[model samples]
Target: MPDYDLNRLGSRAFEQMVVALGRPELGPGVQVFGDGPDGGREATYDGTINWSAAAVGVPGGSEVWVGHTVLQSKFQIKPKPQPQDNAVWLQGEISKEIGHWIKAAKAGRPRGTEA
Candidate 1:
């Protein structure tokens, strides 16, 4: 497979690409969200996730995930991006998302909703 130049795409476009790539494996039930605050979710899946049958070259795909699953997409615009350059920022962003989810859980808000 060829490496995709994700930097060419805007954030929402990147999210769309992610969703398109995942929908097959995640199933048709995946819910896609739009711009603004997504409550840290770009996409949400509530059912069993499996490798698409075509993905695994099998009649029926194998199970991968179950229950609520949240997807977040981050696009790095810097040319020739390196993971090390964004490591700290990525860690912080991930922590922020996790914190948001924890706070939401404590507040009894649903998994996919904003506070």
Candidate 2:
């Protein structure tokens, strides 16, 4: 298993989620802390767009967290239509990520054994 830092992993995962969303306008706002000689304690990637199609984060960990918030054209309590055509883009993104995950899993399997 690959050991990854929580904040770094979260940021990367958030960025990947945005790319996976396929909406150029929906890219996340990423910020990093601790760039100086002394390393800082935290970092974050704030995503402005809501990912109704997918969620990111580990399955079972207290430190693991996932959140999504959709922005409406107006501040209304009722649901509203998203301006971008997200259906097709979301499908393609899911397919691509699933394929990559499958490939990685296969590659990680023991040599000469069924994947």
> Could you estimate the TM-score for every candidate?
0.75, 0.25
lDDT tens string, model 2, 1-115?
Answer: 9986433445445444444444344454533333232111123344554444344463432232244322211112222256354555556655664565466567785211333
Against the reference, the lDDT scores of all candidates come to 0.76, 0.40
lDDT of 1 by residue, 1-115 (tens): 9998677787778889998987877778989889876777788889876655545755465546568888787765663356676887777778887887788889899755763
Query: Looking at candidate 1, what is the lDDT of residue 75?
Result: 68
Q: What is candidate 2's CA lDDT for residue 76?
A: 21
lDDT, residue 87, model 2: 51
Model 2 misplaced regions, further than 4 Å = 1-84, 109-115
User: How many angstroms is residue 44 displaced in model 1 relative to the true structure, after the best TM-score fit?
Assistant: 0.6
Residue 86 in model 1: lDDT: 88
